[model samples]
Target: MARVRWWGTGLVVLVLLILGLVLPLVDKALGSGGTALAAGTVIAVGTERAGARPVTFTVPAAGWALDEARSSLTSNAEVTRGEVRVDLNLVIPLGSLDNRRLWDGLGRIVAMGGGRLPGGPSAVTTRHGTAGLTGPLAGHGKIGSATVFTKSDLGATVTASGPPDAYGRLAGEVRAMVLSVEISP
Candidate 1:
């Protein structure tokens, strides 16, 4: 009986070791799968260019700009679908990212469709939205029903594809960041 028990323990240990070594590969394989790749590609577009002059994000509100903006990547995950978490702090300028109010965080407009606005000194129109995007490499869905944050601290969920459709959904980034912009009004 003791010998049998010893054999069982050995088998369990071997299986555990195999799983530990093999699971990572399996996860990687899945992560590289079409679905995950698509999702990641979609999300990365908006975030990747965050450093640009006007930082834009989408929230439930629709579209709005801030005086200033700051963003950070909190976490990211790969599964059947990809998921990424980014932390952000934005201040609406009296104008756009380049211009700012004399004070910070004061008079900052919380936008929905875009997080940070372009620093370029130009009158930009922020697009507000509440959309549901869905499709293959490129998604096609109703953007109105989707909400963005910049506008009114509202929540917007984006359901779209990545790449190709550059403006359509901002490459799957609309849902993650939906905020409103503040106008001179």
Candidate 2:
């Protein structure tokens, strides 16, 4: 019994030592990793074949910033470049977590990335006598049930708008890259 108790005490001490040394490093590693991931995703989107001139944007209402830009094609078909800015707000279920909360989920996810508006300078480009976009977008929403749904589910209306045919297709990729991204909280 004495020997067994000694062994147990030794195990506990070893566990504590390991935890004390590891937790802080783990937290820091996670934070840095999140930053790198976000950066890479943004850069990739900026470089896509959508058009040219990549720019980043910041929206105060959404509490986030994203990189964006514009592009073009061989054909005279023009584009506006990056033309939309989104600001996201997060909300939680006020009533219950059941059906009521499920319904509340809409307001939250809809508010995800805040709201969209006429994008500003960096992302906008003038070509073919029209304006279009090809860039990155960054913003934040809230956490809670609504957030959960946004991550797990995104709707069609969330799709982007741009030129047509090839240029439009490329712009769609940029939008996909933007939406797929989720900054660390």
Candidate 3:
């Protein structure tokens, strides 16, 4: 009876150990796969221009994380929380590109990528006093906004999207993040 008890205890411990190891994997598979980023974390986006400051934005709320696999410093940066995702990209126009032209171009690019800008662009100013254009974005059963902030030859575009409910719940946070963008002189 003592030996049987020992064996049963060992089997239970082994099962528990296996569960402990496998549960997190299952959770990750079902949950967000990236590492979580704390609220208030400032993230630098885009490459630094010569003798110019690099652009950066703050994570306005908790539950966000940098999607490392889908992000690249030289090209673009993507961050996600739950179903919502925010993407930032730096644009350098080959010629003189006005805000409206840039916004239109970005819309075309979005359409090319199987997305659509359902609304026209409207003027918006970031908290840092940068001027930009913003409009509705929809694709892949998600809805959000696409905004472009320009300063001289350099421009930065921020796109945020998710399911309607999730996007609505996090709209303020997303707006805060977009407004928090800073393009230093």
Top TM-score model: 3
* Stretch of 10 with least lDDT, candidate 1: 136-145
TM-score of 3: 0.80
Question: What is the C-alpha lDDT profile of model 2 across 113-183, one tens digit per residue?
Answer: 57322232122222212122222222332111111112122211112333334334344334433343331
Q: Give Cα distance to truth, residue 118, candidate 2, Å.
A: 16
Candidate 1 residue-wise lDDT, 15-69, digit = tens: 9988998888888875543321222232221223344322333233222222122
> What's the TM-score of each model vs. the native?
0.29, 0.22, 0.80
- Better model by lDDT: candidate 1 vs candidate 3: 3
- State residue 114's C-alpha deviation in candidate 3, in Å: 2.3
| Candidate 1 Cα outliers beyond 4 Å, as residue runs | 1-5, 32-89, 92-122, 129-185
Error of 3 at 117 (Å): 1.1
Give the residue spans of candidate 3 off by over 4 A: 1-27, 30-32, 49-53
